[model samples]
Target: MTGHQKTAFVTGASTGFGAAIARRFAADGARVVAAARRIDKLAALAEEFGPTVLPLQLDVRDRAAVAAAVDGLPAEFADVDVLVNNAGLAKGLSPAQQADLDDWDQMVDTNCKGLVYCARALLPGMVARGRGHVINLGSIAANYPYPGGNVYGATKAFVRQFSLNLRADLHGTGVRVTCVEPGLAGGTEFSVVRFQGDQDKADAVYSGVQPLTADDVAESVHWAAAQPAHVNINIIELTPVAQSFAPLRVHRDTD
Candidate 1:
């Protein structure tokens, strides 16, 4: 979606993978509509990229706001060729029994509902135009669940299935859907948000581990989007060499 003048709308563009993806497309000459809740960070992005980047303050969790944002885009950016649903988070790391209900609600709202809202809003336009790509940010947790990954992982699993179902629905519509799942990514506000602003706890998640960087994830997204129109990438799951599968947990009762 780059190397020329294509419009790419990216959510959660305030920082991390979203920001990196926005920059990646903009640097390649694509018009980028960088949307996020933090206007200041978006402003910084627009300032850096100048006219190529249109910074729009957006909270994807708000369905009405998403509809309005999409319908209200300026003439130049209204025709979004690519929609990157990158606005999502993990609220808490506690196990299910001890988890906060509010955290679970938030995870579902942002990671699941918000994503569906964005896709629903943009898909029609893509179909009308006969060409578009929806790049969703999923997680390895969707397939490989960890103890504390309850709601977060479930929401991503929803994302995975939803992407596949979308393909089934859009078979010959000329639109494509791809889910990019990453494991143990670092250098993002993801952990900080999950830990509820506890910097120390967030830092510990990547300590002594060369986790996947935001750029790595962005590059994967870029590659998927840049593929020829004939090729539709179903899913791209990746992780750092330092990260891989773990042995199944075994529990034994002690008498």
Candidate 2:
């Protein structure tokens, strides 16, 4: 493993944090495999990064597709030294009593089961090689649950626990696991996707404040990946200065 150029596999790399992470790793001289469900978007990323980036159309929710993609990777990028589990989303904003069960299922399937599938598919090779790193994208909701966060928050909590448990299980195996949690990230598909493409509503989410950008989270991911093999950064929680914690910001009809 020493002196060999490393390869990184990042899920959800069509845009947002995943795209930034893929670019950063490519710039750092690591061969990057960027996978997402959007083939055209992934093609654009590959075009932008050239041969160093391999863009594959992959849906994390499909276990068979995930395995096929991983197994079909070229030999040069087959032995992934880093795996970033970043394919997830928040579907509906509703309280537990009113929440859409379908949305809840999607969140759980992607955030938890999808992450598990990726890890399970990749970890054995990492362990066999005796060197690798795993970075799972968590959120502030994991610790500070809000009324509408319901299942989304719960899934992140699972991510937090899963990362720690993976670290424990992989102890002494030269494999490291980390969870990167961000508070209020903007300039990504987060709010847009959450609001289901309601531009006005999405814009309102970051209207008056400067939220953390995809680059910020990407930088953190790079920092974790760049650490020495022996050094395992457990969890990193990053938030913009303007945001502290989740709260109901009610604006009365002053006018």
lDDT top scorer: 1
Q: Which residue runs does candidate 1 get wrong by more than 4 Å?
A: 1-4
Q: How accurate locally, in lDDT, is each candidate?
A: 0.94, 0.92
Clash counts per candidate, in order, are: 0, 0
Using Cα atoms with residue i matched to residue i, what is each candidate's TM-score against the true structure?
A: 0.98, 0.94
Across residues 114-158, which tens digit of lDDT does each residue of candidate 2 receive? 999999999999999999999999998999977699899999999
| lDDT of the structure predicted as candidate 1 | 0.94
* Candidate 2: clashing pairs of residues: none
lDDT of each residue in 1-255, candidate 1, tens digit only: 335468999999999999999999998889999999998988778888899899999989999999999999999999999999999999999999999999999999999999999999999999999999999999999999898999999999999999999999999999999999999999999999999999999999999999999999999999999999999999999999999778998999998
Worst 10 residues of 2 by lDDT: 243-252
